[model samples]
Target chain A: MAEASDEQLMLAYRDGDAGAFETLYARHRARLFRFVLRSIKSRASAEELYQDVWMRVIEARATYKPSARFTTWLYTIAHHRMVDHWRRAGLSVVSLDTVDPPAGDPGPQRHAEAREVLTRFAAALETLPPAQREAFLLHEEAGLTAAEIAAATGSNEEAAKSRLRYALAKLKSAVDDG
Target chain B: MADERDPKVSRRYRELGNEEPPPGLDESIVSAARRAAEHPHAPLVTPSGRHRWYFSLGAAAVIVLAVAVTYQMQQEQPDPFATGVSREAVKSPANGRARESAPPAADSSATARPEAATQAETSGRQGAAAPEARMRRDEAAARSLAKPMQAPAVETPQRMLERIVELRKQGKHEEAGQLLAEFKQRYPGYRIPENVVRP
Candidate 1:
């Protein structure tokens, strides 16, 4: 079958078609897993949270409503799950500011330049508050609108805009300093 | 150098700086989803068919018991005035005999003959008992009015299922899920079938 929309796949899954769920999982899993990994910083924890999120989805299948975009809804669940995991572990929230840039083996000069820029950018992203980082990621990586970000974060539109603006300014300053 | 100074620096960063996710993440999530789909924790403790029948029977039994108790109470306490009235009616003919023994008069006898005597006797008995009969009826009405009204039993599972379906149809899946969770908590044993959950 042609690729179905998230809403279509969810509805199909609700209607007892497991394959539709598989399709949805295939479409969203990598991005969701990455998103969780970035927020939580532990590969094993990310994997566990990933399983928990999908299990939540399954438990919630009977009651699924498509009020927001599917990915927005999915990310909200992931966000909450991460928050819960953080709380339970009694770990202090890590400031994104202190993240060291990943240093790989020296390669082509162009590749080296790109890596430096990326490393600086990652360090800058780590400096932002979780909410700001989330807003930025949703905007830059997921291509969500301010409205969608607000909905995902349960914040107002103005707040989402402010966070996005701050995130961009911080990234710009970090890159300049680097 | 000019590219770094460009106004679209933020946009460029976004385009070129996206992280590649770790491998095998998708496969793991899909595997988890498949496992959940296959082994959804539906307890087989109560069959729906038997549960519905039991509910119906319980409701029926309550209604039947209420009616039987009411009937037994009514039979045990017959209305005193009704019985008195019926007794008076049975004894009216005997009382009529004394009225019939009265001497006849020329002017009034023609009009006051047998009919007048019988009418007078019947009217006296009914007049004596009418106030008591009215009081009994009023008391019965007051008793009925004093009883509390019972709300109809809610269709617990079916209504919740329909609500979830309606919410899903409206694309409010998250809210629907919350409501269903609340419903499940409220009615712990009711298994919302897999078919209902799928859509």
Candidate 2:
């Protein structure tokens, strides 16, 4: 059961194998959490949206087709839920190229200079435009390719690639400056 | 499909730490999934797939109904030009031009005219009743001319109720009562409105 692919687990669940859902949820819970958390930057909202995404998966089990990778389907739901969240809040993603990156905390809890670089890196990530941040997070956290990122985000591959490239460049600069 | 992620960015991103959702959130989601799986409601369908089938079926039904209605209407109708046949010419036996034109009356019903029928009998004796074979075309045309062209609108239940209400307001008790009886007979199970039921 543990060795089963995500698609197989989802199919089993669709066919009324209750235990299959548990296995699938366990496999994705952490990465999906981090993905949602990083996208929203609000722990409360992220948790709520993350749970909603899974419930959507459950509700949509009757109609699920294994046409695409299960991960893409899962993240696409996450992406749409986040988009709805932003819409309800009357927020829009804006270009952050000109906005000055916020200062990093480099919390005293981290004793090493390397830990300070990690803190600065986290801060720089927060400053990126929502689109770029999402692309970067999907790439790093979900292990999605440029093509997969486009699939999840509903953007063209070129746009996804451009956003990820810009995100990597900005984060790299932040590390170098640290 | 290529891996475009930068190694340095990837390393730094990893160092940002793996933040997991709280235990409670995970439990709630997993419980929901299990419950749903155990008691499945129905399989989901893609909007495109479901709507395509429904739209296709609806469109096909509409087309078939339209064709049936058109064919039925056309069969019931006389040739529009049949009404244009000169009644004066059919009445006056001296109209040589009308007689010549009337022999080629295209519709079979055109022979139903009295004069045209007489011509049909004469031609039948000669076994050459080519166009003047109908015997009642003029009678049907005359009946059609006596009635109004447009059909009256079909009375729906709601419209019938409104008419009954109008009749009641006008104090035509006898007519309203008769119409109300007819309405009830037509719609055996319609719920009478409270206002219409009163008085």
Candidate 3:
């Protein structure tokens, strides 16, 4: 249940407990989906890659090990799948044009000013390079540390740190301009 | 790790993060996971499932190799009893034609003139038929193989039983009993009457 760690749940799934997999999926689904959604920036392609990541998890459950943090491995698979998607789609630059902004209302009756800032946040995210945005999302969404991000994305820790710094700086600048 | 006091940026990221994926996509993803867990070894409907064919291919290769080995051993030494061909004729082709024309069956005491028949006496193949039995077998084989259009029917166990019964009735109980013993050893699977076997 809630007391079990992600690794424990995954190990249980590996031993053929389907409920354990459902628990793991429920725990991480939102953050993982957001990671893929914001990384790819296209609802259609994001869903495609999102489903693919989970399928990879289920397929690899039998071989699951405790070698690394579960989140680290999950994000790593996500990162690699994104890389493959981009490679196949001819290296199209990751841009804000990928995900359409929310149509009319800023959700849940937040103040107009905060809504504008959130919109700017989404736009700024799309503007950043895919690598930078991914590092930021891995930190904020998956709650991975800089070292974990580097492990997931196959970059040095400093590089992951730099991307997060650049991403946060750009988003701050976008908000300040507003 | 930078600006710990930046509530505004953190708050804004949380707001955008609230943008949940569509419920339909969530349903599809979870359903797919359940399906995968249900059948871990089944290839997926996706592109990855194609890899399972390697298992089937390996099984097929083992089957083919086993069949090939069995067939080769059979060809190297066919069943002489089953084929009605003399072992000497099979082993020595130079004497094959002579064996083919000989009437050993017409006179079991006088075997075929094929040189291989003479060599049968000295041939040291273990488990081979005894010399006298082998000569009579050559005649039985010739009668069966050379006159295939009217090949004499092979002796049935019942016919052997009847002959043994006659021998017993003729006061040659030892010979009849010995032959009965041989018949019982050869036809263990046959359900013969115990009274007839002993009598």
lDDT of 2 at B38: 62
TM-score for all models, in order of appearance: 0.49, 0.53, 0.54
Best by DockQ: 2
Shift in Å, residue A127, candidate 1: 1.2
lDDT of 3 at B98: 75
Query: Mind giving the per-residue lDDT tens digits that candidate 3 earns over B31-148?
Result: 6666667777665444347667877888999999999999985665322323334455555545645765654321111222334444453453444756665664465456445554
DockQ each:
0.16, 0.34, 0.21
- Across B1-199, the per-residue lDDT of candidate 1 in tens digits comes to 0111224445434433234344565555555556656666652122467587887899999999999999986765332222112222223544323332432111111222233334444555677535444444444334334432322123446766886888788887886786677767777888886644655
Residues B1-199 of candidate 2: C-alpha lDDT, one tens digit per residue: 4787778888777666677888887777776776776657633322475677897899999999999999987677543234433444444435523544543322222323446545655776786665535333344345345532534224568877886788789887676776677777778999998767655
DockQ of 3: 0.21
lDDT of 1 by residue, A55-147 (tens): 678768878998878888887787688778878873222234433333455568856676576666666666678788777766765557888
Question: How large is the interface RMSD of candidate 2?
Answer: 5.6
- The docking category that best describes candidate 2 is acceptable
lDDT of each: 0.61, 0.73, 0.70
What DockQ was computed for model 2? 0.34
